[model samples]
Target chain A: MSPKDLEDRLVLAIKRAETQLPDDVVSALEKAHEIEEGSAKVQIEAILLNIKVSRETGAPMCQDTGIQTFFIEAGADFPYLGKLENIITDAVKRASSEVPLRPNTVNPFTGKNPGNNVGRYVPYITWDIVKGEECTIHLMPKGGGSENMCALNMMSPGRGIKGLKRIVVDHIVSCEGKPCPPTVVGVGVGGGADLSLKLGKRSLLRDVGIRHPEPHIAELEEELLELINESGVGPMGVGGKTTALDVHIEYAHRHPASFPIGIAVQCWADRRATVKITKDGRVEVI
Target chain B: MATVKLNTPFDKKDIQNLKVGDTVYITGKMFTARDECHLKMLELHKEGKDIPFKPGDMALFHCGPVVQKKDGEWRIVSAGPTTSIRMEIFEDEFLKTFETRMIIGKGGMADRTLAALEEVGAVYVHYTGGAGALAAKAIKKVTDVYWLDELGVPEAAWILDVEEFGPLTVTMDAHGNSLYVDLRKEIEKNLEKIHAKIENS
Candidate 1:
């Protein structure tokens, strides 16, 4: 509840984020490696090796350390609400310099910046208030390369599966080497613009091999995966069969005229970590 | 085999002898620049200002490094390669103006860029992206910097002394071979087969 405790928690969260790759992501990458065929097998192998090298050296997983994004779910009774926002901003500033993450945040209009954490809309923080007395934080270091490949649309429900497939496959194929494949494709369906985009990003947090709980959505995931691989946008977009490592989809209810779908492509590094803090002042790294 | 140094304006003989997957270690004055600097250089070229270094036979790394200052001098923080496709627009023209023979970056370019390289006898070398710390170790010294007063550290041109600077692979060679494009095609064919099997299964 105090400033010191918040600072320590912030520092701990940042370090945990830096050191450990998420278990779900790791598991997914392993599965991808297991089923991977073609020259892409080597790329997957190299990516796994890169994870090792990055961890051992304490360097970032990719040269593009990505824009720091935090998905924070906090309880109403959480002690540090008043000071938490500034604490997070300050922590991001400290971590950017200390973790020495690549200065990915830039001034969109001016196209120039201090090359530090200070920027408009930087360290983009998305928050959700909940009932519990604890807080959970999810950090994803999103790289520019993969972010470039993200796409969205409001499809006609009549356009159906075929239409959905066309947009996703085309966007990825067009991206080619830009997003640094073999990528993990995150698909969000049903929600409104912001929610659809959020679902697309949150879908990335799902472990690689796991499918949507709904069998039909999972089937769509599989089908899209096939369609994308068939496009021949292989590892590093060098024209391989393994255009995507996995495709995870999440959905919500949408307006009658809307079938909003968002796609967020994650490069191989897929850096993410989670931390939970309880009311008893215990911190758990997930 | 271990190390070699060469200056710009390489001849056809030099270009022909070089092959894909060969490791090259370059010496003699090299400049450190990335996307912004490249854009600025092109603008300068258009306006007919004195070019920084003769472009030929030099390595222009695709990087925007992090830097710090100590004792009133700029120093590198982490200098790693960025994906080169972001510079796709400027490369071909830049190649013609600068007699640069060795092009170092990650990912190979498309047909137009490749054509320019072959015409100019330039070799496109792929450095391991994300190896900023490792790459920084190769920069033996920082000689001088240009545009420092205006552009600031990471964005400025860092004239460097490099030794054994590369484990570079010729992703696109002077002979019109591109490992990345070729590899992608090979991967695509196999993927098609796998998809067919999945559909049948």
Candidate 2:
């Protein structure tokens, strides 16, 4: 496939991610709305309306279009491997103006906005290479409100899984409305600080109700979801039965000395989409 | 809870009567200000220079919007509220100095802002987080913009004309009540129970 073709598809994926709330997230929200009453219900109603409006208008669901992040699962033998980074960068620049994404990238020290989403190390891409003949790209436009609530903790290994649960609950409860509950709490366990956070954010890419393949991890996810909802920081934290739509946990092997936990919170918008490209050059965006 | 429709240049009595949890929809003029704008506004005040608009007569929105310019006119594509607590440091002073009557943002603010709302006869209102398209629908026009070049678009102050612009719930009111504070306490109690359960399990 021509680089332009791939870029165009990438832009389409970004537009889809920005304007449309995915089915799983929308369905979960609908379920929450059903169970909530009073002010909590009002907030969910507004969110549903907002989702509808954005879908109809083709405008971004949120003003903070967020740091454009892409996750790539690339085939080692796929063609155009060397050019993928540049093509993706160009696509982000085009999408910034074409989709009219908010110019979210800023120079930390100078505070200069490029006026396009692209900046140094921005349009942040995470790559995973596997033995396949197809490549898949996922776009997750993470808003600032929830991004600010991300936390990382390095704990003594002796504290165990109970310590991990306490840390997660404490972090979520303290953040309260700040991360824009009913949020999706993504927990990354066992990796180093950065890897743990990355895994935590990666966990958010999973569909709302899907459980981990491992029974133990899935149980932990369910338990954390219930515990978080027990906080009653419903909707935008106005107090209700549903503090979180779901909790997703991803783990990696940890060193005997350290147990690092990374918490990544995603707001109700949960904006994401995927684009798949086969080696045969067939492009599909979902 | 009661739903109230308020016009800008709000009367003190109207602000005072609003209790925490009361829903509000605002009409007339409001200005968008995020972190940079707040710092700039305060800097302008320190320099004894007048800001382009009268903040005293407008609702201050904690927003960094996505705007577009076409045919020599500005249009708001998405204008949802940014988190309000980021502005908590400057809000009390902003209220005292500017006498701004209402604040619209996502995520309720902290103690200083809650106290300032009571003292200044103002209220902190929360728009639904991430509801940018719905927010843009309420904005009628972009009347003026300040510091577009200096602060850049998102951080610039966008003076907008809006009509019935919310489902803005009053989370912090002029009557010394704050729903955020109450929610925090509730969550703290729940956390204790959850921790205990985690330990037992």
- DockQ in order: 0.28, 0.81
- Screening candidate 1 with a backbone cut-off below 3 angstroms (N, C-alpha, C), the clashing residue pairs are A234-A240, A238-B184, A239-B184, A240-B187, A241-B187, B55-B100, B56-B99, B56-B100, B57-B100, B57-B101
User: Per-residue CA lDDT of candidate 2, range B58-100, in tens?
Assistant: 9999988899888999999998888888898989999999999
lDDT of 1 by residue, B1-201 (tens): 222345444565776567655556666556766777887888898898987666554577777666656688756545656788767787878788776677777666777778788887887776654545556556667767878767765567777767766556566878887776676666556545654654454
Candidate 1's TM-score:
0.84
User: What TM-score would each prediction reach against the true structure?
Assistant: 0.84, 0.97
What pairs collide in candidate 2? A181-A235
lDDT of each: 0.71, 0.90
**Residue lDDT tens for model 1, A39-133:** 34545555666566556656555656677788889999888766667777777777777776656667778877666665777778788999978
Query: Model 2, range A1-286, lDDT digits (tens) per residue?
Result: 7889999999999999999999999999999999998788889988999999999999898888888898999999879778989998998899999888998888999977787788899889999998977899899988888999999999888898888888998888888777878899999998799989999999999999999999999999999898888878888888898789999999999988999999999999898989899879898999
